[model samples]
Target: MSHMPTNIPDQSQIWNGPAGRAWVEAQSVLDDMFSGIAEYLTAQTRALGARQVLDVGCGAGATTMQIANVTERCVGVDVSEPLITLAQQRAVLADSPARFILDDAQVHDFENGAYDLIVSRFGVMFFNDPVAAFENLRRATRPGGALRLVVWRSATENAFLTTAERAVEHMLPDLSRRKDGAVGPFAFAEPGAISRMLERACWSRVRFEPVDFTASFVLEALELYMTRLGAVGLVYAELEPRLQAALVECLRQAYAPYTIDGRIRFTAACWVICADAEA
Candidate 1:
């Protein structure tokens, strides 16, 4: 494996460790959970002439394979070796044209002006310095190249996320102040802040659209679901076994209301953003 540059040590450790392995194991489940919005994002690309495509934060090669079906050349890059390994395996098994690499998009030296379109699903929010990270991304794109991404809007707006977070925080004391600019799923929740970063990166024609969809999580039981989650599982791992059991019960109860026809369903909201490199 080639050296992958990462500016965030904590994030690098987390993703390359348990979090990445968890995603690889739960890849299919995650695909089912997020495929609705992911497919929606891809559907919007019919009008674009994307011969070469880049899928940033592409986990397990699902989105990369999807893009490869349409584009001449496609590549997916991620910081997680396990996920990248799974992605590469899937690509090889499926005889896909998409290429997978383990690298950080924030600092990787992508060939300049190589990609016609760049897309991400719930990616691009983990950068230690978002503006600088995006500036690097801008330099990777050709003039007038388009970039599209789907990012969680906010914790308040996404019940699927907030429910679990609320339940966890309610059971356990607030661990930290959740320092601003910390890399997490909700790092780019604020649309205005993300827009300013894009502007600073010198991207033009930037736009954000709210996308709402019913996200489904298939689990035989809430206990199974609880164990499969990476971050939450890590949090639960710290507690005594008895406390962990209590936490699971609380999460199950909190999730009960969202179960529809025996499937866990929640209203998920995200910002579908698009922009063009300076022409």
Candidate 2:
């Protein structure tokens, strides 16, 4: 196991703790939610004709395993121990050739020129120092290797993810304090900024493709989903009971407009980013 770097201690703690465990428990739902994106990524990997591939922040190994079926070798790297363990178990159960490592990609010691392609799905956005992380990934890629990533466009564009946060904003004033360039999911929301960051890390020919889809959930499970796996869920357990109930009600009303025939659907807006390793 690679030592956890001090720079990402908070992230390490979050993923290794409740967030990791939650992902493990919700792996099935999460997989279903991102299935379309995973398929798109797999198709892109095949199109690239990559033999050895790397999946960064490969939570529960869905995309990694998908890539494995089309590649000679696929390795998944993540910092969350619980998520990594779950991914390993799933891989073994499915007899997949994918391998996983519980290590931070930011500072992991990857072999130089080992991979022909690197891919991620809604990952690679959490690094404290994204430039340093991309530089490490660049070192692991062969000359002219390709990189593909799917990242959220913005909170407003991804209402499926931010509805709960917005619903409870009055209660949690901090939710409205988001800014550009923060080291979170929306850190790469700005295309120009991220393109420049990747270039600084020595990746070339960066480009972005817009991806829009609907994320659907059974209406019955909406509340549980929000309180358990959503961003607001991170702090849901600490709130007073009255506040919690109020939040649940707020979310219920907020999501009502999106409900139809026992299901709730919200738009998911993301950017499919592509780049090349410096030759």
Candidate with maximal lDDT: 2
Candidate 1 on 18-98: residue-level lDDT in tens? Answer: 778777767877888888866775675556868888888898888888878877888998888898999999998999998
Residue 52 displacement (Å), model 1: 0.8
Residue 127 CA error for candidate 2 (Å)? 0.6
Deviating ranges (above 4 Å) for candidate 2: 1-9, 174-178
What digit string (tens of lDDT, one per residue) describes model 2 on residues 101-191? 8999999999999999999987798887788899999999999899999988987777666778777888888654344456677878899
| Every model's TM-score | 0.91, 0.92
lDDT (CA) for every model shown? 0.77, 0.85
